[model samples]
Target: MTTAGGRPPRRLRADARDNRDQLLAAARAEFTEQGTHASLNKIAQRAGVGAGTLYRHFPTLAALLAALIGDDVDALCATGRDLMTHPDPDEALAVWLHAVAVHATAMRGLVATQMAALRDRRTAGALAACHDAIRAAGVALLDRAHHHGSAPAHVDIADLLTLVNAAAWASEQAPDDAALLARLLALITAGLRA
Candidate 1:
């Protein structure tokens, strides 16, 4: 964002960037809990910034959402390496898959918002890159599991990803989340073994 002054773009100073980051972080938690309908004012207050600042950075809710989803997808993709260090491939996949599930469920109502962002070709590109990053993580997890000689070679990483994503979406309907997820994982893992 530049002014007509031919100077550098209106770069947010380190402190302002920090403020923006903080606001976005708060917005993430708030959105996850309450969704896009969460209180933007509370997000600002939680970030220790004025409402005006939040409005300045994100004029509409759509802007804030794209930022949050982008942040989450990026962070989750980076977690694959951390999972690889785990001693148990099964356990590693379990945790990472649950995270992916949570990530999908977190966007319960965000698809519409994301669509608007996607209309901006740049944002769509960013979103695709984000998905690809997560897909790479899934591939790595599959490879690590194979290396451990745990899951059978025939098991498809894409299938696991679909299961996790579906479970995440279905979780909203379950009363016993832990038991449900455990049962789902067990069924999937059994199929892998077979």
Candidate 2:
């Protein structure tokens, strides 16, 4: 944002910052309950703001999701980086995959949203960056596993993530099964073994 003179705008005013924070908090809750297609008007209502306020802050659903998940993405990437130094490449990859599954499951319908955003040119920037970061992190761990002869050489990051996303979706469908996510991840990791 810029001032009328075209210089960079100052930090958000206190009230504006509070509104943004409230919207994000409400959005997180709504998304958890109703998935990515949750009503924007409902999110605004939950945040005690008008729909226009939400639009002003986040022009698109992808932008809102990017802001919402940015922290988790950063943490996931950081975990992957830290795991790079672990002595057991196979174990590291498995652990990271588990983490990814948990993240995907926690976000409800995130996999679909991410895939849609990646395919849409209008959503090319923020959401694409999030997807790219996740891909990079997973690829690093996957490459290490392949080099150690634990993962199949033909399994690329896209395939792995798609499989993981399916597992996440299954986990969502069987929410009563507490062990479903872990079990699915185990099967996936085992299948990766050559």
Candidate 3:
């Protein structure tokens, strides 16, 4: 493959397309079963491709790892944007938090290099874009709720939405993540109440 501007080289040929998809499937399964040590050779074999072919598609282990997690991250962020079209901001926020929890848990298993890239991205401009979008949605809904006397005057919409994601991350680390999240929502809404 060739590249410029961080895109995968030109359009993949049919054979290359099959190889790439196969590699992704193999890698996902291997990572799930064997954690980060899922060998490249094993993945290549599972995908019915040679190690050289895997390396050709992904020059390094980090490249492959980044590709896997990066695709998912892009999708998750897109979902955050799409949630704006939902009529209910609070419900949208809840769903976004849940999606983040799931994606975070899955990405946590990525190789160290890939994880660092993901971490760095959150500290960059992407974080601000995501945060602002969420806050805007929350403020709109919360303001309406306040007009109806269902939201507290002093509640900080920005801070509350931020806290929700932080709590969601913590919930992701727990064994009973679903139960933990249910409790978290109860506690948060209790505090955020009108």
Please tell me which predicted candidate would have the highest TM-score against the true structure: 2
* Between candidates 2 and 3, the TM-score winner: 2
Expressed as tens digits, the lDDT of each residue in 1-194 for candidate 3 is 44557777688899999999999999988886776567889999999999999999888766676567666666766776777666765566556656654554463344322333443544434433443443464566566545553456787765665566556556656866568866886677656553
Q: Order the candidates by lDDT, highest first — what do you get?
A: 2, 1, 3
In the range 7-73, model 2's lDDT, one tens digit per residue, is 9987888999999999999999998888866899999999999999999999988888889888988
Pick by lDDT: 2 or 3, better one: 2
Poorest 10 consecutive residues by lDDT, candidate 1: 109-118
**lDDT agreement of model 1 with the native:** 0.72
Clashing pairs in 2: none
Per-candidate clashes, comma-separated: 0, 0, 0
Candidates' TM-scores? 0.62, 0.91, 0.58
Distance from true location, Cα of 83 in model 2, Å: 0.4
Off by over 4 Å in 3: 1-9, 111-113, 116-178, 184-194
- Please provide, for model 1 over 58-151, each residue's C-alpha lDDT reduced to its tens digit, 9 standing for 90 to 100: 8776577667778677778778779889888877877787777667767453533354344355665545565667778988988888878477
Candidates' C-alpha lDDT: 0.72, 0.86, 0.64
Which is the leading candidate under lDDT?
Answer: 2
